[model samples]
Target: MRQMGRTNRARYLATFLLGYALSGLLTGTWTSVETLMDYFKYKPRILCVESKTKPYFAICPFHKEEDLLVSGSIRDTGIWDSDLTHLLKVALSLYKEAMLVDLGAFIGYFTLYAGALHHDVLAVEPSNSSFKRLRQGLLLNDFSATIKILNKAVSNKRSYVHMGKNQKLNLGKMHVNSEKDTDDRENALKNEMIETVTMNDLLEYIHVKQAIIKIDIEGYECKAMEMSTAFFKEVFVPFIFMEWLIIRTNMNSNETACTWTDAKRLVDYLTGLGYTPFAYHPVFTLLDPSAVLDWEIDNIFWQHKNAKSLLPYINLLRKVGPKYFDKMDQNQV
Candidate 1:
């Protein structure tokens, strides 16, 4: 009986140790696999994504594809900016044909979409990697001939400016640092010098009689607006779609920060030029600029006084609902 007890004890100890070793090995292997996937997931690739409008090929970074473009149930459904695209379609329907200026065109989703719909598009991108992808996407979708590509940053001036430091993990956050006030050497070292052009200069070059302007240049919208105040007064841009950011309350700099003050100034400027602001909450509703408290949403549309006749169309958009998905086929080039 004593001998049997000793053998059983030895077998139990061996089993416990073996189980612990196997668990540790499996855990380590899982962690390594996850790390490897994260590192390689964002490498650039060309993917065919089905958009709400039409099927198009997107040259997407692994991060954007995994996180934003393909996160939902449908792959590359173009739902990422469905609201903006829907609004664009409504605007185009109002005007038989119009020119679209996609400032900060990124991977040219909006730019290529506009071109695919037979609208003339001016797509601007500043980052080298993004620009290359935008160009590739345009070509992939056969929009190269339809859209004019500009590999430069948009600002209130025509000069060379330092591009924002690249945050490899989040390329969309890349912005231009015009202030040059940061003391971080590492951040400064990451900046690349890029050509910048004013909205006035670009419009002059394009010479479109009336166009729809879409601005999504991070937080630089105010600066671009400030520089193009004269152009706003002189030209007849029927629609201005922009992403507005709340200004840093702590910011004491005289530079444009798209803060409340900057937003107020923009309101005054646009209203002075007979333009009205409306918030696009899936549907266009008149926006009281004074009531806006934060930059929580991404889409705002400004209508020229001349385009007030299009207000009824807003209700039509609301009534149509998800049926707009079918409209994409109707509008496809």
Candidate 2:
């Protein structure tokens, strides 16, 4: 009986291995064929891909495979990066004529969306590859004359800075002062130094009467706020969309991440400038001034005191449900 049991187990193991090998081979064959098809479909030059937000393109000569995958995913799949589509539609509708300022505007997703809506747009991007793609996307959509593109990192200081070392996977990861002390200097990724500018510097060139700003500069929100306080005081920016990433973690060090203290300071600074903080989870949920001190979330929208008239629009967005925002592809210009 023991001999018979051993024979059954060996047969089962052999069968499992055979099935695994066959499945792997089939998958490899399918992937190769699909990749070849994609190369032919989008070869010679990167093609403009349409998302719910707007049409855009991405290209990285050094990381051609990954770049093509990213661009193709956006083109072929309608479901790529649709999280903010709904919210942006509602927000853009509220202020049709407001200037849209897209900081860290990688590949010009928001910039193109605003331009398509016929709103004057100012887009700032640091990485060389991303900026090139941003320009391509703008021109592809025939929005080059409508939207202004600046290839500079937005930071507290107007000086040149190096991109982070691990940006080979996605150029979007590139940011100012991204090198870690522990990173091996000899083997580290070498990125070109890009020019840096402040929000105030860009504001001088904007001729728009009203403005809305969207900031997603990795973990440099605090530094940006510190630099743009004067601009906030002088300008009546109705809405400010920024990422708030100050949550409690088990990590031993807080040096690399934005802390609760940084969030509180930013909230205080913005509030002092007469802007109210609210959570932007695809719907406009009002946030108490002190709530941001401890609350953990990614996107926060701040409304200026002068823009109290926008409350009705916010309420309308709340009643429309999240689905209403996704069906806005038809609203694209």
Candidate 3:
């Protein structure tokens, strides 16, 4: 009996040790030595950047497929989506009076750049942690007054929502939980209840005549759009740029992050609004409304007929191919 007890204890200890090792390994998987070095070196600092035509301040970003175009691109360019950033500038110049409604503004790259140009802007971020970072980054600029920051998530209606975490991604990818989905009651209750605003409700805050809207709400954008029908009807949004990862139909739900049914609804809704979609390969190419799943663009512009006045600029940009603005050195990153 004594020998048997000894063997069992030994086995138990070995098993416990193995489990602990695996847990540490799994937790530290993404935290490579290089990532650790970068974290310590540049964790939280304001970067002064002269992005060609626009000089702005960017806050230290969290680890993201963004900390930014993601894959740690900020270390090189001190910017992400340079193509999209410049594109917004051009849109603002053409619209002149257009307000930039930057939803999911994520560290305020688009908002920072637009506000630096002295454009009226409303920037929204859902995550408290990310919202703090975004606000700090934007406020460090001289044109901070030009931007209005909101810490609530935008949904189809005003309500309380539980925010969900995608550990695989960064805070910018944090999303509103679908009422039916969450890990469990205990953790759900622990998570902060986020307030939501309908897109139409946003209008009361900004008297937007024409707007350049960027919505990147992870998978929740489809649900948010359901309530945004009124906003689209009321606002003259010439450029509605969105992340198609949540609405593309060609891929399975894993890739699109939404069902084919939801994707179809989103696409139909935009089309019914008389918006034509355009993507750029080497130049801006008009996309077939039904086939957004096949689009190869990084992001898309749903151009309404109202934006025809800006066609010459779009044509020129595409002719020049995609321009990448701001290649700052390590200190700026």
Candidate 4:
């Protein structure tokens, strides 16, 4: 009976391994086909291979001579890095000694890119599991020395926080803004406590020359911004981009603080502090403030009033086609 049981267990193990290998092959084959269909050239691709000489690196498609390579899992979103690099090049041209702060540094892909460009970087992430992956990416990309990783959530207050229950990342280190209506979203995840910090404290710790902040804290962007008022006042960060999405009417989540209503208020608040808000389009400049408040999907923003800040992007878009500019003007809120 014991010999028979062992044989059955071995058979089951072999079957499982075969199934896994088959699935992996099938997925890879499908991804290859999809890549060919969506792209005409390898220019949009960023390769990640096992190499001891350099941990991870990417060659700029637009400028082969200006490859901004680093250590990280480029396989996760190499295509996304293309978009990020384009944005970074523009930002760097604006600020000579730029200090980039990525508020929600998930997996550290964008952080590594910014850090590798010789910009001083500070990445703030709260989830231990997420931060683990982020740290690995930073180390793998060899960005450990330049990039400062802070494993804490930024909020309006500086103290220990209860992140509550979150199944999305399987970590309870997510921040909840009690000041807003976030009960439905919090309840969905289950509630627990986690560590927290304030923006003022973080800024004071990492004193830098210039800064550009990307705040994508899911929904806690409002609290993060409110807490970092000191930094906003002191530093002239030319850009402050956040994710604003229109969701179901029933979802009372603060995670969409960059939505139409919240973005209007936030943009107004920032501009009130002497910052000019500009709506960013991939093709051309649409300097309407209300357009951001009018968006139902995600959008980017330039906090400073420099009209030239978006000229290159605008020209790039216009070169694509006139329809891009027409649609942009039509979408203005």
Each prediction's total of clashing residue pairs, residues at least 3 apart in sequence or on different chains, is 2, 0, 1, 15
lDDT by residue (295-323, candidate 3, tens digit) is 66556778887575445556655566444
lDDT of 3 at 56: 47
> What is candidate 2's lDDT per residue for 166-256, written digit by digit as tens?
3444555556673322223333324346776777788775887677888878777776777885666555588887766423231124664
- lDDT for each of the candidates? 0.62, 0.61, 0.63, 0.52
Best by lDDT: 3
Q: What is candidate 1's CA lDDT for residue 252? A: 36
Error of 2 at 214 (Å): 0.7
Taking every candidate in turn, the Cα RMSD to the unseen true structure, in Å, is: 16.0, 14.9, 14.9, 15.1
lDDT of 1 by residue, 75-106 (tens): 43444566667667667656646788889887
- Worst 10-residue lDDT window for candidate 1 reads 1-10
lDDT-best of 3 and 4: 3
Candidate 4 lDDT over 187-209, as tens digits, reads 53355434567777776656775
- In model 4, where do residues sit more than 4 Å from their true spots? 1-77, 164-192, 246-263, 279-287, 290-293, 306-308, 317-333
Model 3, position 85, has a per-residue lDDT of 66
Better of 1 and 4 by lDDT: 1
TM-score order of candidates, top first: 3, 1, 2, 4
Count clashing pairs, candidate 2.
0
Candidates 1 and 2, the one with greater TM-score? 1
